[model samples]
Target chain A: MTAQQTLWSLKAGERCEIIGYDTTLAEAYRIRLMEFGFHPGERVTCLQAPAFGAPKVYQVSATVFSLDDDVAAYVQVRLEPRDA
Target chain B: MSKVILVGSPNSGKSMLFNRLTGLNQKVANFPGITVDVGTGRIQAMPERTLMDFPGTYSLQPISAEEKLAVGYFERALQDPEVDHVLCVIDATRLEKSLLFTLQVIRDCQRFGKPVTVLANMIDVLDNHGLELDVDGLAQTLQTPVVPLSGRSGKGVDELLASLRNPVMPDTNGAFANAPDALLRGEAHALSRRFGPGGELLVRGQARLDSFFLHSVTGGISFFLIMYLLFQSIFTWAAPVMDAVESSLGWMADALVPLLGNQVARDFTADALFGGVGAFLVFVPQIFVLTFIIGLLEDSGYMARAALICHKPLRLFGLTGKSFIPMLSGVACAIPAIYAARAIDSPRKRLLTYMAIPLMPCSARLPVYTLLIAAFIPAETALGGLIGWQGLAMFGIYFFGMFIGLLIAGLVSRTAEDRYTDLPFVLELPPYRMPGFKPLLRNAWNRSRHFVTKAGKVIFAVTMLIWILGYFPNYGADLGESWLGQVGHWVEPLFRPLGLDWRYGVAIFTSFAAREVFVGTLGTIFGIEGADENMVPLVDHIHASGLALGSGLALLVFFAISLQCVSTLAILAKESQSRSLTLKMFIGYFLLAYVAAVAVYQLTNALVA
Candidate 1:
């Protein structure tokens, strides 16, 4: 089963495909996210969730990017199958 | 001469490629804005061709101040008649993101009718991982010459040089230049998916390291240890060289002072040249050691991870993770740190960073701290000699200064009017690599030379003036009767509450020119005072004078808090563009330093009593 959720919902080592950004996300941030290759259909993997509420690291479109939880919450994604 | 603009995203090895092409030791930091000034150098292969290394940027749209500066200069250079070509450097391993920026550059170059070449950097990493990128396909798709090269390994650089001889313009029709950015973004994504390296090779390697570096337990432990080591190394590693410089200066004074026939000339040579400027020269090695360690952190890409770790805590102080770079750079010197502040996206955070930078325990403060600590703090070791008391004292004062800076930032950011909203904390974590020692050593040497040639002149002039003023009339017989003594006594009351006499009062005033001048001024004063006929080090002179420990500690506190350099004030005025802000900071810090020094002085004396 496929579930749609915010990118922040993905735990460490989880995989997802970009769907779109939330409508509530500001235009400036949306454009920047898109410029960073977070467009629809892009694949992302959660590489790390640093302790004490530090920004999490994610692999977006083959490049690593660190985003705070608030910004990550705006990126909508669909869960991808886990590797064996 | 034909000019080429070198542009790329931050951490794409663009600066390294510039070094490879031009053979210049232009700094390449893991973070952005290492090229705050446009560095121009002739290409090593074709001396007639000049390359301009612009500051790195993520997008042509320009978000941060540095990006805006880069994009602005890039656009203006495209219009300049002398400009010939635009070379866009990209990391082949992270092809998709690099292509996102490359696509924008290509689109912009098309609009400007300028020829563009795509230099795909860092293929050595790809080769090690056995990943592949289709250079020809990428070139065919973009209609620009794609030269894949390893900036670190110098592979494919000859081909890049050859390609530069006959640069090609985009063969696209007029319609391509008008494509919307959104459409170009989609096209870049599609192109990378087809031609970029396949699978998860790059991210996996970075992730494995991040797991250890970003872990709650290990990361925290390593961070403190690394920071402690940085301060400790500055004192311990540089001590032997410092002593060598001291003894050599002593030998030179011994040989040179006797040769002078005239008594006045003998006193001037012994007091002003050797005693004053010579004392300042002993601390130069510490600046070299500081620069080397910081460069190691910067080149190895640990600076970015440190920034990431500092982000959450730094934000509470009304600064971003980005401010960490400038603040850390401030530990070396504040002038470049002010320039490095350009990378910070928000004006509000940038201003707060400026406020904190002057408070960082910079190398200029090193001489005074060493002098005072040697005079007051004992030379003892603990943990079976693993840690020296002097290094610990250095670390304590550094931490104390930084803590006070953060407190001031927190207070100011809370009370000040919010003009610009805060930008999100987005910092690029470049893949960790072993730092190239050649560039680090070269940069350290250059920094030491720069400190000497620039601040050395000022210290020399100040030393000469102090020597003349103290030597004249009574001719060093009675320092209390000298001209400088009279001037110093006039200001002595202002410093008396902090337990400083007139000689120190004079040195404190002279130090405003440069913080290192404090030691030189004191050296000259004591030399005129005839402290020792055999020329003891400044520490011994301070000890022989019987300066109270409380007064010594007070001086350390004062130097730590005060903003002493005139160049820093000048740059603060130019960067902040507000004379009032610079003046307010100068006055405010002085007042705060005075109050704190007096309190420390009283408290120390009370405890001792």
Candidate 2:
């Protein structure tokens, strides 16, 4: 999946596992993602992606963080199915 | 006596280690030509030995101004005759980067012929991560002894002290003895290249975490929730402790009043000394709690993350993300918060941050806000009870300060034409570890001690001065009838539109010394003799007093943004080294406060009536 497509596709509060990055756009993606603790095999839960399309808040481990929309568009994630 | 200097990166638990060694016998004084205080403490390792805790710094080649002070000290120490041993403290988890500085110090020692040792602190954290260092190998490589110690646990501290007592000379001719000139030149390159694989994985792990927390939508909501919890904790948890302090002061005042018997002495002791200053002392619990949380954020490395997250929003006001740390700290006390701005590198950005910092509703303003908000605004939630309106109002006050700060920063940048130099925004997000007890307690105690000692002296004198002014001339009559009363009355007209009486005028005037004095001043004016029962519920007090709602709201708005901290301004002046800039800041904030208060009062009164 494309980086931008992966981010835009996630619903708020949805859990997703990061399998790996596509190395084609890796360097720019790596530097941007490093600041937020995103990496291979890490799971991320999106807390907020506002309707007006602003930056989103996320929970990785114990620490809570905020990232702008432009920066958030660089990450790819495998969406997890919701439990009924 | 040989002096041992303890040095490390900022927030590397150096101060906690210092406290462990020396206990309460430490003295913190400002380094010459800088506002950063050099904490000196005598640790008697032997009958005839002492150790000194040098202020923390990131590098020998200074990037920020405070780090430059450390560099300058090293340069000066080379020529000074009284110097002795150097104890370099390194964070075990981040040993690779810290070792770079360690290497620099070793190189300096090799050149200058000074004795040196390395203490690998936070070893416990390293062991937990399943990482083991070859200390003996490191020791041999650097030609200096390496002792693994935990500052929090007191483990290996005595052994480290013993090593310091019986100093070992480093081999000047060793392989690591020579300055790694190439290594120093290509430090960042070396960091990424040597540790790239593992570091990349770590970076990726951290990025995954950031993607979740730093999301714009969720980040903002989480930020507000965190802040709400902080405020609620300060208000609810600190109340009982505050009461205990108030009750103790009441007991002391009662005990002393009978012993003195003289009315002048009695009144001075009860009203001037205890009533004025004692009232603020009760809030120390809240202040400590706030400081502890802030210190935890800083120590755990989450604070920098918070700063980075908020950077863009703050930058809209022409501030860097780093400015948020100091501004967040300003909520606790502006004195340290202003000093905390030392972390921000750009002169213009630092000054702008400092100028707007006091606008953050500090603990000193809490009593006043609580009094006003309780009296005026009913406890109602905003947006379908997702959050309390009172909490939102409190949040709005913070948002207002940040807004004004950004507005002022933007205007200043536009008018001054000073280029905003952006420093590389690199902060280490150390793995989350439970902040250890000794370090946490020691930090809280030392900070409280600093607050009680340095700021306390000024607060005590100011509180006394306010008491003497408001108490005497109006001796038998109401304060409105005294000489100070008359002066307040003349100023009263200026504030009348905002709904403040002469009594309120006197309180506001006194509050400039310290904002918490507003509580004491009101208590004294209302003839509440003791500190314990000084604050009547805000609604009851205001309703009974017949203050127009518009006036109360206006007064609330005024206190919200007013620069009532003289100590904060003094620190800002010292930090920036410009009296004119300090004066400009003071005038600008005060003028903005007055104008905003008047506008709010007028608009609200017109709308309601």
lDDT tens digits, residue span B283-303, model 1? 678768777787788899787
lDDT tens per residue, model 2, B1-609 = 556677876656687788778764677666555456666777844535455677665567664555567677876765455667888887665554465577778778767677788888877755655556567767766678888888888788987977876778656675555545445534422342343222233334565555555556665677678767766666677778988998999899999887996877888898777776676577567667766766676666566666666666676676767788678767766766775686675556787787668777787777787777767777887777998867777777767776776677777766766443433334444554456555555666666665665556666777676666666675635776666676787889878878888888877887787776677667656766542234564345557778887887787788888888655665566666667777887777778888999999999989998
Candidate 2 RMSD to the correct structure: 7.8
lDDT of 1 by residue, A10-79 (tens): 8888999999988988787787788788888888888888887888888886788888866888999988
Segments of candidate 2 deviating more than 4 angstroms? A1-84, B10-26, B92-95, B120-183, B186-228, B320-350, B362-402, B413-422, B474-476, B490-504, B514-554, B565-584, B598-609
Count clashing residue pairs in model 1: 0
- Give the 10-residue window scoring lowest on summed lDDT in candidate 2 chain A: A28-37
**After superposition, candidate 1 runs with Cα above 4 Å error:** A1-9, A19-26, A73-84, B25-35, B171-175, B257-269, B278-280, B321-351, B360-400, B416-422, B457-468, B472-478, B496-504, B511-557, B565-584, B596-609
Q: In model 2, how large is the Cα lDDT of residue A30?
A: 54
- TM-score (all chains, Cα) for each model: 0.82, 0.73
* DockQ, all models: 0.66, 0.06
Residue B287 in candidate 1, Cα distance off native in Å: 3.1
